[model samples]
Target: MNIRFDLRQVRAFLAVASTLHFKQAAETLCITQPALSRLIKGLEESIGAELFTRTTRQVELTVAGRLFLGECQQAITHLERATHLAQQAASGDIGHLSIAYNDFSINGVLPSILDTFKEKYPDISVDLVYMPSHTQHKALLDHEIDVGFLIGPLDMAGIQTFRAALERIVVILPRRHHLADRQQLYIEDLKDEKFILGTENGWREFRQYIFNICIKAGFTPQVVQEASTSSGIFGLVAANMGVSLYSDCINRFQRDDIAVVPLDHDDYSVETIAAWSMSYTTPSFRLFRELLESRLGGES
Candidate 1:
């Protein structure tokens, strides 16, 4: 009566209540009969109620025991269910994740990664945001987005970058262009041709990468026009406004007015990285990273 009671008492009481026998309940609970008896006595005394009636040959629940039993069973069930949900959350099996992506990533590697990830962890609710790399960088910094699939090198502080895909730069020219019939085009081939490119916000680092590629090819490209959207870039190229360089992934969106040709250069590939705040650590983010990394490896 003077002893403290806790979940141990509740468990012992449940076992004995279910079996209506101390020796048998002790066996089920892996405890000594004496310990089980003490636990039941303490729980009864602490609650100021006799939960069971005992005789020389019989044990039966008291009226109070019958009523309390249902609630106790519910309590145990709820506790077990809550524990399971917590474990799932810790393991990245269930949660919400906000992922920011660029235009090229949406068309290319992101879809496969998302499909595989959703198939494996269907409980996770994902919010996809279409944004440029520069905007995504700021969102990552502010913790607005969980992660970003964008072109690199981000070269920013407080951000961790993982290589998600190696995207090859391809040439998108008008179907009737003299070079359209060529199987593959080199950077040198486009040196003299006018270029259609994304605006600064659309691809800051990637724009520089493109410029470097042209510079590496021994000539500066003449960017005669700029388009903010991928579809707009295609429209510009289709109209014969200028030829453009885009990720090989864009070939999925085939246009009859445009000729998609692969680039034949050693440095034709651009590295697309998964970027996140270095300080932010979430199981959902880790799960996404692992799945994306696997998808990227399979792609290569």
Candidate 2:
């Protein structure tokens, strides 16, 4: 037979079993004694068993009632836990988020933002994935990631974006380079110098920015070597492979072999932006976005 009992019937049975007194169980259930009795009678009938042996002086559980009591209590406990977890999920307190970041952002403010978010919502799981800026643009559009921190001004239809950092361009050169002694250098000064840059696959957007700045400076960069990551680029620069134009975020790293000098032009700056698709926001992502909004508001 199909079990046709409802929560109220289960609760009424539990209350009566706990008290062993009909009047007390009725009071515990906040129902009239007659109503409580109807619930228990319906529950027992549905289960095909007599749950209690009623006496004028005392009410006692039958063998079936004793067995039902233990299992019923456990079921109620599990149900309550399920309800609590569902509530937490709805309130953005527990969930999972896939977040993408590029080299520049992971080395900058993204870490602090993630730390603060994790502290606030300890149960929410965050998976950080490294993705190039151009790849992140596609990932955001395809709903593959919840958020992306990458090179900015991501003007796309369905994607929302906000500037996360504005870093001035700087030159990273070998310490012994002739121009490294200058307090500041202009992009034009690097026109004749060999450069070590990131490869086009992983650093296409950033490379484009660098190329544009150099082109505006009236000369193309002489790329002597290409590295796939920031560390590789730094290692190449340290070996005197070439000097590279990069964001001032290089200051965050301590490298005795390389000098980071400010670029003289005010027109060029590396902008990092946080991007997300409005269509793919989950409860966890909403919480993170709210935190980002508050942080951005404070800065503004």
Q: Write the per-residue lDDT of candidate 2 for residues 1-300, one digit (tens) a residue.
A: 677999999999999888999999999888999999899899988999999999899999999999999888867865774576588679976687889999999988798889999999889988899999999987887667889999987789888887788989889999999998899887889989999999999999989888988898899999989999999999999999999978888898998999999988776798888899876677888899888888765231
Best by TM-score: 2
Pairs in clash, predicted candidate 1: none
Estimated TM-score for each candidate: 0.65, 0.68
Question: What is the per-residue lDDT of model 1 for residues 12-75, given as tens digits with 9 covering 90 to 100?
Answer: 9899888999999999999999998999998998988999999989899999998888778867
Worst 10 residues of 2 by lDDT: 291-300
RMSD, one per candidate, in order? 17.5, 16.2
Instruction: Output candidate 1 Cα RMSD.
Output: 17.5
